[model samples]
Target: MPDTETPAPQLLELARSLGVATEYWDWQGEHVTVPEGTVRAVLEALGVDVSTPEAVRLSAVELDERPWRRVLPPSVVVRQGARTAVPVHLPHGTSVAAWIELEDGGRRELVQQERWVEPRVVDGGQVGEASFELPADLPLGWHRLRARVGDAEPAVAALVVTPDRLTLPASVAGRRAWGVMTQLYQVRSRRSWGVGDLADLAELASWTGGDLGADFVLVNPLHAAEPVAPMEPSPYLPTTRRFVNPLYIRVEAIDEVAYMPAAQRQLLEWQAEAVQATNGDDTIDRDGAWAAKRSALETVFRLPRSPGRQIAFERYCVEQGEGLVDFATWCALAEEHGPAWTQWPEQLHDPRSAAVAEERERLADTVELHRWMQWVVDEQLATAHRRAREAGMRLGVVHDLAVGVHPEGADVWGLGPALARGVTVGAPPDPFNQQGQDWSQPPWRPDQLAELGYAPYRDMLRTVLRHAGGIRIDHVIGLFRLWWVPAGQPPTEGTYVRYDHEALVGILALEAQRSGALVVGEDLGVVEPWVRTYLEERGVLGTSILWFERQEGGVPLRPEAWRELCLASVTTHDLPPSAGYLAGEHVDLRARLELLTRPVEQERALDEADRAQVLDAVRARGLLREGAGEQEVVEALHRYLTWAPSRLLGVALADMVGDHRTVNQPGTDEEYPNWRVPLADGSGTVLLLEDVVRSRRARSLARAVRTR
Candidate 1:
């Protein structure tokens, strides 16, 4: 029995603080249109019951700290400025202990211990008796208390301890690590259907970490995108960021598929050849590869799941419960909305409406299918992570967390009210583009994220960390500020919106320490210099590209000056590969495309001289033979990167094979074949994974940096 009247202003404020840009929401209406699938995703994020008719409420309710579980690491809460007892709800027949862990100068010691009896509540709930104490002498920061019953057991009825306040210390050190970047999709493998998958990632990690003695391998985001016919090719513009794309799943490695009946096996095996066709020297056909795998998975899922498989699936379902439901709902809504939900039906419009619940129940099968896909993707991703670790990767499975999701995608749909509908995030006009660029994706409001305690951010981080040893935060400057273009406005009309830098860095540090994963920010633009210093103090690493690692006076900083914690790469997704850079293909392409802001001839002349100097520097470092040619000079540049003192180095998959093309171009989408090209060798043919590993180029590069 909840009130159905208009939500209070405070609620609206909460929504706004959480990045909600709308005062009211109607899912099916014109003003507040959201893809049906996106609505479901929002609902799922809030842990709403899809089958239930009641409109699920999304609120963070405060209550007396209660014991929610009775396992080890029992949750507890700390009161502000006082050592006190706050009664909390608990499950019946659960044992608990309460104690506070105090921190002083980086040392953690337990204090203020108290035990309590289980109390019976009149409202048919159990409560814990007595309160825990806090030290008056403790300095301010996040301190936690634990109510525990068992060691090494899942938490049962424990209260969640949250400190009332904290004062961050000033002298935080910059990270002392580094990583390399790679494009998995471009990292073609012998076994891959057409594009790279987790298997290829595992292989790269093994070589880079075990052989090259690198700390981490940074990479492009692998977030799930719209799985429609003729799928959107760009990895940056994903359908959903919370889930992995099923297209990247390694089907041949599935345990259930391996145990399938002979007839089923034969049917799946028949499709392997078609899937393997892309593994040859051909441009990647993403749609064809996914089509084959999707068909195969549907059949594999149909066969009765084994007990062990059932257990795993059930566990996955439980773990991904609300998130899965929402994604599925969005998938269905995307179908109903077609191109955009802004033009969808009125009655079924609002994400929090009863109409959505009804539609969700009516379209149960479709919703379930989306959930199944997520489960499979999660499973495969986890398997890949495990394999990378087992293969002796020093820091396995460094994942790429994209800067933002597509405007019409799941994240935007779920937080429509919070996200500004008319504003799209992008970069200001730079030397490269006279007319700035608009990414067409909504960005989170800084104030909104703070008020919400960064729950969405936290949840997304938790999810991504599941299959990663570290995470590369793409476009890291977004955490400090973002260039926002008002909807319908030109990119040039955009203004910079500032973010909560302190909170952003704080939460990031907290999450990183919690996950035991290193944080590398892609700080590669006209960023505020203090931003890097701040990130460093917080133990977060900055991205350092060799091409851009120059001092104030146009002098290149020595390798030792580069921070060890930062990731050093020769190029990025938007840049040309090593071969292309050395061969002057990028310069030629830009000149041909008229992308240069300066005179074409002048730009070309300057670029040629710059390229020559870079090659000369590589040769001087002994990275190349004295008389090395252009391609060999490119190899030498890579050798310089691999041997750099930086902790992590990302060798783009394209660079590993001497591929020249850029995987993605920022300004031009259709004008240039962005994200659609394959990783090719010299002579312009696609390079197969097996063939790549067997090639002289790969061997030469591998041998050059096989320090470990």
Candidate 2:
């Protein structure tokens, strides 16, 4: 923990110093008086020099007590070509400001700014209403209306200004809703030797949509990772969120592959064999995988760039100019300076300095190489999405947008001031992770992001949604509140920092609306209950993990009570596969690495009981027969998960393949093998595509998808 004793005061001071609202403050109970000296002391502790009256004046703008989510409501509708009236409910003692802006550069400019809309003095829950009017002179295109109340983030929605207010698409407004969340590289593929590539994704669409009746296939983040050894295994910490990872591209699936030279085609086959051999077990080597793909792409790059490929590349470059250039520059810097740019020479390190541009020009080939790779990734992903749509899928491809980027990544380098320099994003201590977890990624500067009109965020969303029908925002609470650990502080010693949640959700809604994409928030752990309600109201889905789907206030919720606004799952990548959890493989895996906090015997004893109880409960629920075998247990669990009320469901690839280990473990990095775990059969040989498809468990899962 930091030397500073009072975190709340210091946190409030920090927010005040930054001219942002603080979510909480220290006030003597019912006093209506706060110590000015206490506030000053807090400011000093956070390293703010606030002696002057101007500083005090700024800080005096009463610290905001409400959470960001409370301030921001979800969506609203408006009529076209008329001054429309709409009444919206607000929280107790809330203040609302209403305004509208047309697509054609016209603004209504907070016309009825900051009107206090107090709730009626009722005995039950608080609720009140405020009325706002829309602009009459709006164009036929989409318009936006915004209303803000208190510390709540503003509520925003796009108004379809048309002659007729027709109902929205069935995928958006009706019952045909479901999206798949896949780890693209980890999918059980047929064509490509081992890892799932764009071709496999295309195949999955045919299988899921045609055979299993899935609406969408949501994949894990396919964003580009830093292309070097000891690569970060987690897709969330990508080198560039704006670009796709080329490692996911199938060289053999390229349209111009037939025209490749004989030597190159043979090399491709050889590389494919090597890839298969490399991932022949229940582990994946991302570095090795990327190296093999890079070698093959180099061969392809050596040949003439196809006209169609060149045109697509040009279009992408135009769409992503500065971001792409900056990302390529960061990639080049990583090559020379290593992953951490802070270790580089001062002149070459600064992202905006002319020296960096000079360095980029000097290493032009490397930069363009990164660009070419992204273009290919984009093309293949787009093709996969097209295939899913053609297969009659409701929601084509759902992509994952990680909460943050690697601190030494393109996003941080490009949006320098938009990220806090000495802070890291992490979670507070919870039951699962007692000491808490620091993700080692930088959180966006809320004020700076808002000031820049959220361009970086908007662009990142636009890029990720390019070929996605839906997106799962991992750790979605970061949009409203992020647990920020100051540099050199332990993970537990962090403050709940707030953001412009209304603007964030508004931007999300706007983008999702424009792209015709659904939004899902991974809103688990320590989240305020209302966050789910807010997300649901905005058409954003929530994640419902089986382990955490308990009734509020510590009671275990019945499976049937699971909310419809969730993507229910038996296990997540961070946790063990269902079979592994049932068999106590997690305890064994942890024990192997000396990661167990308790004594080995004690841990094993606990695991035995937990495992037995879960199995017994399942059997009692008629999911399993008494004394069922391990295979029987697996089948029963699948049936139980399918019965969940969540509209969308995810079956982890590891579970599907019966792999005991997880793709990632929270704490230990090298202490245990982390992300190298592959999808394999029980015999330990790489489960070939044919073998996986033929498995009993796979058949059962397929049946669940087709029937339920």
Candidate 3:
């Protein structure tokens, strides 16, 4: 199904105009031309008419005339202190006046600049372009630029002036901040429902900050999954990234639970008892746990709310506006007709249709329940942040932002045209993953985002950052470009689609500055070198792992050589803990999952050499002895992290407890227990949050990372 034939010149030109790459160098340093079929398919997903040559020419004509058709450009994003020139198009000899409405209700008139470009005929009329100088002193906030030509209604577009670089929060302004990185679902406490909950998060943050002197607790993305059984286990493959998962709710902690009648209390207690019994299992049982918890949540939802609580809930609903309503509507619809909107009745497929509106009114009660759940999640998360801060945590909870949403999820159903259809986001072939990867999540269409002024992206950021002190953007490179793998095609057949990074990243910086939250971009894998520099310049930190930080000759890079603006860690969630890595558990696990490209022994030997080289560096740096024990070596690895000048240090909770099991493996889906591994040590003993706090090994590793 992949057409390797080169595209015609006109097709190539149109592709380039649409930000599609015709050719790119792979991670293996080989020039690979993107399949022509892939390019055409991606264009089709972006709403281009590419069914025939005639259609292609018509699409190209539309693209060429797009700017001329606009009175003002869709949006203008500029850094504070930088003057920008924006173009305005109008019919020949038509006079216009343009001005900027500042965020604080202030106004500034735009100065027109003369340009000599020839007019072009668009839609049977010759259109001329004029340039306007946007002032350098424009304040940093979301503003509006307005223009009126020939006494017509004023044309307007968004005007955003973002900070050149984000300002660091007080806690991390002048010193390094170290904290625990963990999968919150696997971090069950004694009091949580089978899986970890917000209550567990608060307790962990409080203990880590109060006793361990940690600054923040970085957890996996707690994004919402399906509202029914067989829910997705991987947090990264969530239904929506903008909202919190209701699965993490602590049923007993809800205020209404305390006020329930005796019969209701007995019923909820039964549900809680059923779910809590699975807490000590070897693997996380999300479906079974969610079933019990969902029933309990339904019981809680039925309880009456006090007038004050009702007012707060209503206020939250009003503040969230339409996005919240639509998300809740999706949830109710999913419960009735299943999560996949594609399989729903054809009339209901269009979320904005009259059919959906009628359905929304019919399911208003269920929609209200979902909305209330989000409000409860907000309250509980706010409580966690408060507890962390009260315990002296500098940054408190640093949430994760997953790259994209599920194909049939809420965002895909709601964000309609903003995201491209029929293509999924993934990676091109690389040495590590020879077959490449297909993450079945639709990517945002850059052109549509500009047309819509990026409202969906901005709103998602605001919601996530509301209760978080920081956000780790998974695959932040996606803000610049993404690999678009067309449906029914392998990932290797995909091509890159460039986004307007200057606009996307600038908005992120603006949002982070407003929230007073730190931004860390996961800059791993094959990245364009300047992307890292750009992110750093925007006050976004980068991620650095111990094993991946190697020189061209394959020697371990010294900690001193690491970037100052990074989160340096010995191991991440994808790999086993430091102890397991030393023992080659990742290689063996890969072998078991059949993910290895070579023989197990060969992979194991290569892995050993890599580990030995790192340990040798650790010894040379005076952090370890010639014959250190496993625990000592693990602690020394963390000590190696402390040697880096990086502003942030992350010590995995798994490593603190000598966990040999990895929570996730990159290449394996169902073959490996990815995202299901409970918090455990080398002997396969499941450990609780409290168990981690009391462990001597955990305490020693914490001290090692804390050492300056």
lDDT of 3 by residue, 516-587 (tens): 899999988878999999999889999999999988899988889999999888888777888888888888
Q: Report the poorest 10 consecutive residues by lDDT, candidate 1.
A: 166-175
lDDT of 1 by residue, 451-549 (tens): 344567767777888777777788888888776665565665454556666556656665555556777788976577798887776667788877777
Point out the higher-scoring one by lDDT: 1 or 3: 3
lDDT ranking from best candidate downward: 3, 2, 1
Check candidate 3 and list the clashing pairs. none
lDDT against true structure, model 2: 0.68
Over 4 Å off in model 2, which ranges? Answer: 1-4, 7-169, 172-181, 188-194, 267-276, 306-308, 552-555, 588-617
Best by TM-score: 3
Error of 3 at 318 (Å): 0.6
Cα deviation of 534 in candidate 1 (Å)?
0.5
Q: Per-residue lDDT tens digits of candidate 2, residues 58-130?
A: 4444322222223323333333456765665676556778776677767775454234555653335576666
Top lDDT model: 3
